[model samples]
Target: MTLSAEYEKLEASINKSISEHNPRLDSFLFNGGTLLALAVTIAATVPWPDNVSWLPRVLAGLGAFLIGAERALNFGERWRYHRRLRDAYQSILDRFTLAVEASGVQRDELLAKITADLDQIRRSQGDIPNGTPLQG
Candidate 1:
């Protein structure tokens, strides 16, 4: 990848990481409130056995279902979006910027690292010569 592509990737990763992870607090609020409301509604409508307090179980199930659904959907969407973003960024670098010499690994290796796992990029302080998938 060229320097320009690297820059674009860096910028994009920063933007997306911010967008996805930053909303955790807000998403939590929304998810929690929604599940709580659903649980309450279920409890009100569906009466359980006389011996069982079904409301708690209902709340747990509802909360897990909602949160899991949200996470799963977000993962699917974000995965596609990031793939396109990375490809575009790399193309831009190939066309416009000078070739950036990667010191650590082959381009294919780095690209594989990037496409599969990239959490390591978060802690890198200097220019990452190779986009290797980092183990946390």
Candidate 2:
């Protein structure tokens, strides 16, 4: 396969990786926020009965659990990591695309530079959830 084709494949893979983390991050944020809101709303508006005085506490506990889970699972960190990786890869891809379009450019040298940049990005991905060992 040609280098351009390989780059296209890599771009698609990176896009998939970036998109896969979106729902997970959004779910965490939305659920956490909703739980906290519900807890606050219940505490403010609802009267606690003698038998069932644990509703607000339970809601607050659930919200705390979500926060702890986020700390343990690093959803936010993973989302940021993937975004950074996508940006780095996109920058390299853009440069490569431009090189391909331009005349009298050193395509081979640019490819080498892009490869090095990709390697650097892969190395710098840091500790995120599910191990983003990017395959180029």
Candidate 3:
């Protein structure tokens, strides 16, 4: 197969890996949230001295911090995974160049498409929508 063909196949493989990983990622986030809730509840119900009314507030703050950390880690993990996928894409593109050069295929349109696609991706990440802050 040509480099372009190989690159297309690699892209498909990256998509498949993401599909396969989604279920695991969902389960992980669900479990993490559940654990955070349970810890907060347990902290609230702790039997302490009569003057310990501030305990729940402290526990709640801790719970919020934990949740924030969990979300941050989740984002970082996803970012790393996507970086690896993009690296795979670049590798395929490199191989595609070599193959096309060997076959002397007209490459203008293909290069244009790749450049446009990457530009779209780069711009999309910067387009943030208004939303409530998840943290205080």
Candidate 4:
């Protein structure tokens, strides 16, 4: 394949990776926020039976659990990692494009840098939820 073609393929892969990480990140943040808000609202406004006094406590506990679970997933950290990787990839792409334009593109060096950056980013990622793909 031509140098430009290979570069484009790498660009697409990076973009896909960014896209995949972004949604999962947004879902975690949004769900966590919504769950907490709902819990707070229920705790403050919902009047429960005096006999089953544990209801409010249960709700509170559930809320805390949900929040903790979200944190445990480490979505926030993963999101940041993805963003950083995306940016790094973009920078590499820009430089690659410029080098190609200047007729000085070094395919091996470009591929090596991309692979190294990706490896570094993946290594730097915090523990993420199991069963989720590390890259998109």
Candidate 5:
């Protein structure tokens, strides 16, 4: 395939990766945050029952569960990680386009170097599979 065509394919792949991860990140953070907040609200506001003492225990358990889920999932960190990766891929895309447009270098050589750079960026960022579905 032509260099431009190859570039376009790579660009599309990066965009698809970004799009998939973004929603997953958002869902993780939002749900985790919401659950944690609800847990806190319940823990703070719910009145203790005199007879059914199990209620407080249940609430505490719920609160612990939410907090544990948040920590275990590490949603906020994952979101940040994905955001950084997306931005990095964008920077690569921008640089590649500009370089290809401006350089008088041989097309094959330029494409090889850029492909190497892209691989390096992916490696440095993390080896997490692109577009991998996040599990709750």
Candidate 6:
């Protein structure tokens, strides 16, 4: 295929990867934050009856669990990682698109550079957790 077509394919793949990670990041932030807030709020406020004095302790425990879970899962870290990758890919894609539009012998050189840069970016994914449905 032509270099333009190849660039389009790669761009689409990278965009898909970015899009896929977005929802996961949002869900983790929204849900985790909400639950943590509720737990802390209940634990601090609302004096419980003697019959359920243990409720505040349980909520406190839940708050601690959420913090630990955030550390263990590294949701924010993963999200930032993917975002950095997206930016890297975007820079390469932008350069490729410009090279293609310019229509010169330099297009081939830019394609090779883009390929190398993309490979490096993909390799960097290993630094983060695996199990991504798509890799660019």
Best TM-score among the predictions, by candidate number:
6
- Please report the TM-score between candidate 6 and the true structure: 0.71
- Candidate 4 structure quality by residue, lDDT tens digits, 5-112: 877887787667656555465556756666675766578458878896777777777777666765676655555565666676567667666656653346556656
Provide the overall lDDT of each model, using Cα atoms, as 2-decimal numbers.
0.51, 0.66, 0.57, 0.64, 0.68, 0.71
Worst 10 residues of 4 by lDDT: 124-133
* Segments in model 2 whose C-alpha atoms lie over 4 Å from true places: 1-47, 103-108, 124-126, 129-136
Cα distance off (Å), candidate 4, residue 6: 2.5
| lDDT leader | 6
**Where in model 1 is the C-alpha error above 4 Å?**
1-52, 55-75, 98-136
Task: Sort the candidates on TM-score, descending order.
Answer: 6, 5, 2, 4, 3, 1
- lDDT comparison, 2 vs 5, better candidate: 5
In the range 1-136, model 3's lDDT, one tens digit per residue, is 9666866775675456444334345445547665976689788778768798888878887777767765655643554445554564555456446545653344655555666755554444332222132332
Clashing pairs in 4: none
Candidate achieving higher lDDT, 1 or 2: 2
lDDT (Cα, tens digit) per residue for candidate 6, span 1-136: 9766876787799777666545466457746765775768577567999999888787777777777766667666766776677678778768877877765668778777888987888777667653455555
**Model 1 root mean square deviation, Cα atoms:** 12.4
How well does each candidate superpose onto the true structure, as a TM-score?
Answer: 0.26, 0.62, 0.38, 0.58, 0.65, 0.71
In candidate 2, what are the lDDT values of residues 1-136, reduced to their tens digit?
9666886898786666545535455456656655765666566456778687777677667666766766666666566666666677668768878767654457767767878887786667554565655554
For candidate 5, the TM-score is 0.65
The collision pairs in model 5 are none
How far does residue 7 in candidate 3 sit from its true spot (Å)?
15
Report the C-alpha lDDT of model 5 over 1-136, residue by residue, as the tens digit. Answer: 9668877898898777656556475566657676776876577567776886677777677777767766776666666667767777777777778766765566556667777877876665444433355353
Assess the local accuracy of residue 48 in candidate 6 as a C-alpha lDDT between 0 and 100: 90
The runs of at least 3 residues in candidate 4 whose Cα sits more than 4 Å from the true structure, single-residue gaps closed, are 23-27, 30-52, 105-136
Lowest lDDT 10-mer window, candidate 3?
127-136
